[model samples]
Target: MELEEIFNEYILKSEQLIITKRSMNDIAQNEIKNLNQKKEKEQDITGNKNSTHSMDFFFIQDVKSGETTRYKNIRSTVDEKIKQIVLQKNKQYQWILSESFEIFREFLIKSYAYLGYKDKNIWPLKDYGSIILSEIENKDYSFFLEQTKTKRDVPESILNIFRNTFPEYKKLETCNKLDVNLNLEINLIEHFRHIIVHCGGKTDEKHKLIEKIIKKSGLWNNGKYDSKHYDFISSFFRLKESNDIILLEIESNNQDGFPNKYYDVLSDLMNSLNSVAYLIVNEIKTIVK
Candidate 1:
């Protein structure tokens, strides 16, 4: 496929995923609201003190137990739904990063081919071209190319290609900004994505580092900070705060246990990812032209 087409498709897909997440969030919010209303009504009816008979008391107790079960079930269902949505969103985020890199790689290879630099032995150029060519003489080009797909290095490698080919092409302001933003945001997202995907959302050393930073900042004291106190930390982390402060609950331990606040974080990340993808595509178009 054409490089431009590939880039456009990635951006479109990212935007669609963001819309899906937003729709699901709205549904979840409404469901929670309805659930709370139902719970309140049940409590009012069951807790009425007008009934004095022993049988009425037993009946009311039974009704209260049923209401509690229903409430728990509703809450559990909503939580699971939100978790699934979050997992899907995370996958889309990773896909955008990987796919963007892939398109950039293809563009580099095509650009080199266009320049009549077709020594298939070095089909995809690398940082150390001469050394890679030497190794290829003994092994194979595929082996050398395969080694270049390191996650953290791919963006830099692609940028290097752009710099070498279009030496006179001044980097667009948007691209420069995107380069900086992606370096920071993608690294942070990738750290969490690694844990979420490989370790089944389990915390790891990266998370510990994050915790240490949060602790040193003194925003959290034994995970007992008021919900309002999340503003500074959220802004630092580039996370969005939910409109309702009541949604933020102080758990016994703040050890990243998939709180509702994370939904806001995921939402903000998705929006940013879509924006970056669009900017990158525009930048690529300008450079390629």
Candidate 2:
């Protein structure tokens, strides 16, 4: 596809994914609210109440067991639903990142192909070639050489390839730096993607990443509370703004002890990916001319 066509397709698909994520989030939130309301009503009816008369032993035992089972079922269902929603959201989040990356890579390949580098053996840049080799069946040196024949001995990084391939575009230097920064910022997302795909999103790596993010947010300082970390945590988590500064609340029983709203995190990630992709694509277009 043409560059514009590829970009539009990506945008359309990404937007649809975002919509689906929001819908799933809304469903989860609504279910939680309804459950809370039901619990409140049940409590109102049952709280501080005593039986007027003593009942038969077995009958009372059965009644108590039934009530216990009812409450247990409610809690179990809510927890299960929340877990399912979170897993589904994480899956969607991973898919969005992977798909966006794939689209970007496709754009790169197509751009090179457009520049008359049509040979399949010459198209995959070295960095990308190594990644492809690791995933594919062929693990031979000859396969690697064939895939990256254009610069086999002196393989170039993606940034180096972009820079060397199109030196006439001076803006590529800054754009390449932006890409590096974007990749760093999105590394956590990538880690989550890896964990979700390979470990069912319940690995120690996920926990470590979560801890790393928490530590970086500066919320905990030398075993003391620091109110100043609020803005950083908020912005990092894309939480609500306070005095024009983003702030997040650490809630107990949330996913990974963070806010249960990973939908917001995924949304922030999607926005970043879209913005960076736009910038890179436009920069590449400038080089094409």
Candidate 3:
């Protein structure tokens, strides 16, 4: 397929992903509202505003011993239910963001593959150009794109691969467009992806890679000054640093796990990714001859 066609498909998929996230969030918010209404109804029936209802209880079973361990009063009230749902929805956000990064990564890989397929003159290593082109034609560019899902420095690694392969890549407008904040946000998204997939959204605060991105993004630097720079990163999520561990916590009010203008935040992140992808594709159009 043509490079532009490939990128167009990627952009469509990215848009759909954002739409799906927003739909799911709307469903979640509706559910929360219903739960609150139910809580109020139950309160009126009981004639006590402070009274709590036991809506559900949770337990775990021990298979070997044939014994069940019940957690008392867990998920018993509307408040608890709301909390659990919010946390689960936050996890869903992480998963969606993870998939978003994957889509972006694949777009990059495909663009490079297209270059290798169309232009042998631009391959950095003259001796192995034919072999690389053959591999790309066979849909076997894993040698170039594999291991790109590593826990850290993913954005830089992607640029490095292209830069090392085509020395002119460093001079490309696409490269120049990848300013520090954009790179920082891309890597931050990758880190959040790693936390959800590998660490379940919990990791040591001293995780050097995560800390580095946070510091560079001005999210936690200089005594936590509120910087208006990170439009998407700051709005969608916040770092909860405590007990020497970092958490992938969604920023929210005490009553809800979603922040004000939550859907806008998701759009902001998706739009930034889309903008970056658009820039790369435009540059690829100039090179793929």
Across 57-142, the per-residue lDDT of candidate 3 in tens digits comes to 67889999999998654425678777768777766776778789889877876666566556644434532434445454444344
* Superior candidate under TM-score, 1 versus 3: 3
For 1-289, candidate 1 gives per-residue lDDT tens digits of 3445555665566656557656665765576566556555655887742222211112222555554222221223333444545445444444443443344344434333322222343235543345545454454434434444442354444444444544433243224544433333444454444444555443324335455434433445776654443343233233233211111212244477755544354545554555544544554555445
- Give TM per candidate: 0.47, 0.51, 0.68
Candidate 2 TM-score, C-alpha based: 0.51
- Indicate which candidate wins on TM-score: 3
Q: Give the alpha-carbon lDDT of every model.
A: 0.43, 0.47, 0.61
Which residue window of length 10 is worst by lDDT in model 2? 239-248
Off by over 4 Å in 3: 57-75, 126-155, 161-180, 206-210, 214-263
Those runs of model 1 whose alpha carbons end farther than 4 Å from true positions after fitting are 48-124, 127-152, 159-180, 204-208, 211-264
Clashes of each: 0, 0, 0
- lDDT comparing candidate 1 with the true structure: 0.43
Instruction: Give one digit per residue, the lDDT tens place, for model 2 in 77-120.
Output: 43455455555654555566556555544444444433322223
